[model samples]
Target: MTSIVSVRDLKKSYAGGFEALSGVNLEIEKGEILALLGPNGAGKTTLISTICGISIPTSGTVRVGGHDVVTDFRAARNLIGLVPQEINLEPFETVMNTVRFSRGLFGKPRNDALIDQILKDLSLHDKRDSKIMMLSGGMKRRVLIAKALSHEPSILFLDEPTAGVDVELRKDMWDVVAKLKASGVTIILTTHYIEEAEAIADRVGIISKGSILLVEKKEDLMQRMGKKRLRIELSTPISELPQELADRGLEIAADGNALIHDYDTRSDRTGITALLKDLQNAGLKMTDLETQQSSLEDIFVDLVRETS
Candidate 1:
């Protein structure tokens, strides 16, 4: 995969001497969905701003489609479309005019046909002539996306695009994202929703303390850090574990009806045999068994805690 966007030793600092980004290095492949995961003030937004030429970097370099962001701002910025976190739009303007104006900003010729398609893709075709003030919050969000796509940039940056959005709206947003990627648009998004990142991203990047902590394929990251949980359900509920079972790595469920044992999938010996024999010896009958893997949220929390 060719690199569509490149960052090397990127750093950003304010006059107060607070650093927002520190020696960050990253590469975004062409036509891939990269989800950036981080807590508040973690430099996710700052990185996106710098890459899109909205902010100047204190040091280091960023290249979009082989154009330096600092030296050639217009070329680099022209290849990028940014959907900011805030919903800022002209309330008095119709959706069609709003989207059309954005296209003109990029010196694009008036193409109502392209603008209409963009609106339809965002499910806003019927509301094209409706004033922005007449639309709902969710519809306002779709208009933002339509405006971003109006210029037809090769890359799109979505900063908390689904924040405060309803469940149905979130689902619809991701479906639109899938279609965008299929059309060869490289997307970089900052989202606090771990499940959304896990679902839509081809790759996941974790950022903390103004640095890139980790970036890897979603499946690979989950498999590497994920733990398998063995659930041993008992025929009868027990208030407490036997003294003999206290030393083992087992926790009682909230209902006291099942014992939970977590083990590494890569481990050669899971200790299941010994635990089962001990349970039987203690007169605890195992009526059923179940298993599950850790979710991305579990791994994210653990990673941040370790780094902090």
Candidate 2:
């Protein structure tokens, strides 16, 4: 896929010498879902704002659809749509009217058909005629998505789209996002929901302290960085560590019912068999055993901590 959005050495520094973004570089494909995972002050929003031309970058370049965001602001901005983290809709405007106005702001001709489809896609058709202030928080978020799609932008930026919504509502929004991806809209979302990214994103980018730590395909990242743990349920509780299994470096569960061993999934010699043999020699009996893989949240937290 071709790159629809490109940032090279992007840097943004606010007054008082606070650096919000630090020489960031990224390429967003034309139709892929890229999720930016980061901590609160990790420059996720700053990168998005600079790319959308909302905040002027101290240095570097951002281009959308081959148009320079700084030099060809209108052309670049026209190709993008942003659903910000904040709910900043006009309280009294009808949903349909607000979406229509957003389309008009982009110099797009009136197209009620497109507007209707967007409302329906977001499950906001029933609320189309209702005032924005009369809707629920989740509905307001749907309206924000509707407005972002009003102009039929090739690229969409969702900044914390599911922040305040319930789990069910968040899942509904994920469905909406999946539909958008299927319709060939490139999506770049900044989210605290690591599970959301793990569920939907084609690629994951971790940012910390105003710089990108890593960017890789979701599955590949998990496979490459993921660790595994082997949990052993002992048949009998041991009061102290056995000398025979002392080299295993196992962790005893708080309840004294289980033992935990961490190992790399990619390693050829995980030492599970040897550990089991050692346990048997030490007169220990294992009642049950289970292995678990580390989740995306684990990988994300590890990256952020390493960089911090």
Candidate 3:
């Protein structure tokens, strides 16, 4: 697959000398869903803005579909659509007209059939004639998506697409995104919800302090960084680990009724077999045992903390 959007040494600096993005490099594959995970002020939006030609880069280069964002702004931007974080729709304008105006602004030929399908896909067909101010927040959000898709962009940027929405509505938006991915639209979304990335993204990128910390396939990231903990619930409480189990580096739980062991999932030898053998040799009675896998949120928080 070819790269639909490419960034090389991308940098963005403000008047006050604050760098929003520093020496960033990335390649977005065609028809893939990439999720940008970061905390506030982590430069997620700045990166997206630069790639979409919404913000001019201080230095370095970005190309969308082989066109430089700076020198070939029109060609690069024409293939992209952005649903920004803010709700900036015309309050008094009807939904249908609003989407149609967006299409016309892009110099696209009037195609009511395309607009109709976009509205229907977003469940906004019935609300097409309603004023933006009269619709609920979720409906307004769907309108934004409809407007963005009106021009038939190949690359779509959804920044905080589900922010400030209820759980049901968020899931609804996820379904919409899934359908878009099915239609072969390359998507780059910045989301605060870890589950959102875990649930839909093909690959995940973590950024902090104007730098990209890591980018990996979602399943690969989880398998490599995802740690598992074995909790040995003992029938009898013990104050200290037996001398024979000292080499295991096990820790006693706060309640003193169980033992905890952390292990890497990627290792061929997880040491669980050895630990169990040691426990039996030490004559320790285990009432029950369970394992827990670390979530993407855990990995993200740890990465940011280390970088900070």
Clashing pairs in 3: none
On the 0 to 100 scale, the lDDT of residue 49 in model 3 is 91
Q: List the residue pairs that clash in candidate 1.
A: none
The digit string of per-residue lDDT tens for model 1 on 10-83 reads 99997899999999999999999999999999999999999987789999999999999999988988999989
lDDT tens readout by residue for model 3, 23-70: 899999999999999999999999999998888999999999999999
Residues forming the 10-long window of minimal summed lDDT in candidate 3: 219-228
Off by over 4 Å in 1: 231-293
Candidate lDDT (C-alpha), each: 0.93, 0.91, 0.93
Number of clashing pairs per prediction, in order: 0, 0, 0
Q: For residues 61-89, write the lDDT of model 2, one tens digit per residue.
A: 99999999999999999999999989999
TM-score of each: 0.83, 0.84, 0.87
Candidate 3, superposed: residue stretches over 4 Å from native: 231-278, 285-292
Question: Could you tell me the TM-score of candidate 1?
Answer: 0.83
- C-alpha lDDT of residue 270 in model 2: 87
Deviation (Å) of 46 in candidate 3: 1.0
